[model samples]
Target: MNKDFHYFGTYSAAILAGHSHEDALRIARSAFFVDLCTQPVLNSVGAPIEAATTMLAMEMADARSDIISQQDVTRTWASFHFLPYDLYSERKGCGKKYMQKYRLICKPNGDLLVDTVTQVKGKSLEATGLAMHVLADTWAHQNFAGTPSRVINDTNYHFFEILPDGSERRISLRPNPASPDDLIKGLFTGTMRQGKETSVMNLGHGRAGHLPDYSCMRYRYLPAWADYEEVIKDNPSDFMHAYCQMIYAMKYLKGEGGTFEKATYDTETVAPYKEKIEAIFEKRQTDDSEDWKAFGESLSGQEIPDFDTPDYLEEYHKAPEDKKDDTPMGRFILAALAQKSMVTNRVYKSGNILLGISGDYKDWGTKGIRAYLKLAKEVRKGGVI
Candidate 1:
């Protein structure tokens, strides 16, 4: 959900849940890192390519449509950005191929979300961040699949923004990649509809654009998967759910709470700031990063630093080989690999091979053997998957 929620909002949630400033920043940094930890960054840092959590624009352009490339895309995007609610959703009168993509549609309070959050219990701060990032996106990315599929991820619905005074403003959009989303005038930008069933335009929420990322937006449209039924996206409510759930998750991770269950939120912790937090969400703006940052700083009395990609990443690159795993980026890398492996395994076990089959990363014969071994360590120690 961009830096607003991924970085600043996450830090605020962590602090509200009783984490120290340092710990909150570490968790928020790892959560935001899911978007920036691309293959190019991995290459510069000499990190294992398999630990790559996100793909850069160039990487997306270079990716071929082969099964191997598809597997890589599904693994990263599905596990990290769009955690599926169910893999065995009923899809009658559809071919087996269509059902695979349909079943990957994301929804909030999914079983997978519970498993992911619980998987990071007693794990590193980096692991908590990764899980939080995934948790928050479940609200923002609902109804979109992680993989590329025109029928599955395409958004051709008529868009409207729900105004504060109970009015509906029909929003205009241009399918121009170069133009930014004009949030002030309520104009948006999205990917052009593609004819190819597997075109990249249909990946995740591209066709829907940044509307999902903005916290202030509440809109209505006919979802492709809803069979002409209208669906209202109440961002204030959904984003609030995400924030509260994150607090509950962090408390659980820190051993201050009970079991991590679906549909549960830590409302008591956020009760004091409910009005202020809701105000920020209801403020119509393209970028709410500044607002969230200000809120977090006010709560902590400590300045929330801007997101710097090289902070922890370069430290991992410069550290001695034997001591790298102790570094922030190294720890994050291990967590990423393990999380990816676990999610991939779950998808396969649930009878869906759309993300490809999962296997033991601990296989010593693998090309990136060190990454695999460390992945095994995180899995075994954390009891994740």
Candidate 2:
């Protein structure tokens, strides 16, 4: 989902779960940082640096160690992006099966979240936040498999023009699916990236981009190659369900529950937060704002620390390895790395369930965790990876 859910919505949910404002902010910030921590860099002077922005920059420097590459960075980022799709169902090449597993739609038999929360029980708050992200996604991202497939998301384009008075005029589009030209023409928003034919890397809802992640967006689109039309009218309900799950999860983390029973999204629980979330969405749309960093800062009520800053780096270096887990940055990194590991084991590794491919990637999770830890050590010792 977008920052609306990852940051603001999560913040609201934390409050609803009875967390203090400060703790709620911390939870929300760590959850949101999952999307922002993609850029792992080594500076010109060969010092590992924190991310300056959320934008992906995968290029590696020649002066840096040759062990890591752009592909490694890309895979790492993919681990984060595909976390919600981590389903070890042992079903290969079935998009619907994967979606059902990923989204926890067919419950009792299909829900993996009960097991997921149980495993991470009594873990750090950062881990809870990470789990919450994957949990929340099961609702907003229902029906879309984590892997890309044209069969899941192929679409024809039709444009709409917004007038000065805030009305829309539809513009019809008719391009051959086989040889479409200038696909960007008359498209007002979303990325222009196209996926390769028959590849798992092909994205669902590429036409709508991140629109599906927004709580207030209600859209219907007919996939050119699919049997059924895709719809997202009840996203508010989905968000509400997600909020309830977050509350359940927090309680689970506190040892108040053995299993997460989905909470009732009644008016008393959902109304106040819904109003604020809807207002944020409306303001963003009206302003045409893409400034999620600024928006996140405003919701957080403070400046997020720049990890590259000396004070932050010094604190990280001085912490004992065992005690590091108690620090905020340490917890964040540990949770982020742990989430990446789950994705590697549950999603990317072939033959578990969902999509299967042949390879020896079982150690990917271990390798990635080791890599991050190594980077942490290097940073502590005044070096870079």
TM-score, per-candidate, Cα-based: 0.95, 0.62
Query: Top model by lDDT, which number?
Result: 1
- Model 2 over residues 288-338: C-alpha lDDT tens digits? 123433443554454534223344334555678666556665666665554
Q: Model 2: which residue pairs collide?
A: 89-353, 90-352, 90-353, 148-200, 148-202
lDDT of 2 at 247: 72
Clashing pairs in 1: none
| Reference-based lDDT, residue 383, model 2 | 29
Q: Evaluate all candidate structures by whole-model CA lDDT and list the values in order.
A: 0.86, 0.48
**lDDT minimum window of 10 residues, candidate 2:** 44-53
lDDT of 1 by residue, 176-276 (tens): 87888877777888887888878777788888888899888888876677777778999989999999999998999999767888998999989999999
- The local lDDT score (0 to 100) that residue 329 gets in candidate 1 is 89
